[model samples]
Target: MSRSIDYGNLMHRAMRGLIQEVLADVADNGLPGNHHFFITFDTTHEDARLADWLRDRYPREMTVVLQHWFDNLVVGDDGFGISLNFGDSPERLFIPYDSILTFVDPSVEFGLRFETQDQESEAEDAEASPPLRARRDEPETEAEADAAGDEDEAQDAEVVQLDKFRK
Candidate 1:
């Protein structure tokens, strides 16, 4: 199979731009009016994590919501960090740059899309970057635990709204 196209970099730039947009908003307007983000990514994708048990639980893909009551939001050349609320508790997370895959903020009807290789890749490793391109934690539920046990990493048990895409 041969085709003349740059779909690889195309998708990469698109995702990069998408992330830049969100970052731009945060940089310029400062997370306007309760407008936060929900990011999902793979834990073992190089720079993502969850609580020990949480990671041991949901090993595949994990998602976390960033809104009010979060703490220690640190953005770096690689990934980001924040403190989010989990099941009746609070947990701090450090998401790497290469782990993030999907980022969405339904409040303003905005979302960022990142293209991965397979079902395993898109398994929700949410964090951070590369040219060939890139980039979770927690299984607060059984599915999370099953996924976590599937991989060996520092995952967490953060909270994310998995029902936004449903109608």
Candidate 2:
């Protein structure tokens, strides 16, 4: 049998949760002693933004290093905003949670592949989630589902954010 899901809005929120969790961790604990991030995002993706010159320069994907010199690591509900040095010139960027294509941290053997806003998030969600757990597809009680949903959201966030982006 075939079934369909409405992952359109869900994916974006899921993506947001992922970014929020990791960023919260970093903010709370201070990068975990050399655990930095190399996040590559779609420069032109709608919710994403970059210095005008930088955008003109790299229209597609740009990899940023989260190191000591970096500044302004702010995470919003929808995405993140930060500034990176692109050859001595500090460039500010706005990356929508949905526009992130890949997140990697070789330190922990971790990486995350963010589905494209249009067609990917749902695809990955269905592929990654185990069939057994979600098979029932029943309406869960508010209290039960609320607790479960929060946990599920966290796990889902971890799976998607801390996944292998290239491999």
Candidate 3:
């Protein structure tokens, strides 16, 4: 058998498309009850441009929540832009699709992990390739899955910016 097809890459691209679709829908109709997103991306990716302060803080990777306090959320073909509050201050973040590492909607226990071309091609050995986790249809609680690790990590990457929206 020949390994001519790059199904893995195709799958990753399709998943990114799904993300764009979901965000586009949210942009158009608003998030339907209880549904939110936890998006983790590589900060150093060439296409990723974060606030200087944010870049300094999350030098490697960062996760953002799309629940309540984000504005001007625009999802485009190559990347996305959203305004979030940081330390009660508003900041805009632009992340390219290729920079994303993981996207999880703990509300529904749906998650997708990605392996970028740069990342996959960097390793000299195939064993070093990132494992692709199959999506589980089962719905679980945020406390159980904890996709982004702990509340501290979530707080560290506080892209939800709820303070400004809070009274």
Among all candidates shown, the one with the greatest TM-score: 3
TM-score comparison, 1 vs 2, better candidate: 2
Q: Where is model 2 more than 4 Å wrong at Cα?
A: 1-3, 6-12, 117-167
Off by over 4 Å in 1: 1-7, 17-30, 119-167
C-alpha lDDT of candidate 1 relative to the true structure: 0.63
Evaluated with lDDT, which candidate comes out highest? 3
Error of 1 at 139 (Å): 20
Model 3 agreement with the true structure over 1-167: per-residue lDDT tens digits: 66688777778788889889999999888899999888889999998989888999999999888888889989999989999887799899998998988888878778877766666676435545343444543224445546635421111224777798988
List model 1 lDDT by residue over 1-167, tens digit each.
88798776677666756665565457555678857777877877755767887787768778787776676666655667777788768888887655776676666655554545663354445532222323233233446557767562433547879898689
For the record, the alpha-carbon RMSD of candidate 2 to the native fold, in angstroms, is: 14.9
Compared with the true structure, all predictions reach lDDT values of 0.63, 0.64, 0.79
lDDT of 1 at 64: 80
lDDT of 1 at 67: 70
TM-score to native of every candidate shown:
0.58, 0.61, 0.74
Clash totals, every prediction: 31, 1, 0
Error of 2 at 60 (Å): 1.6
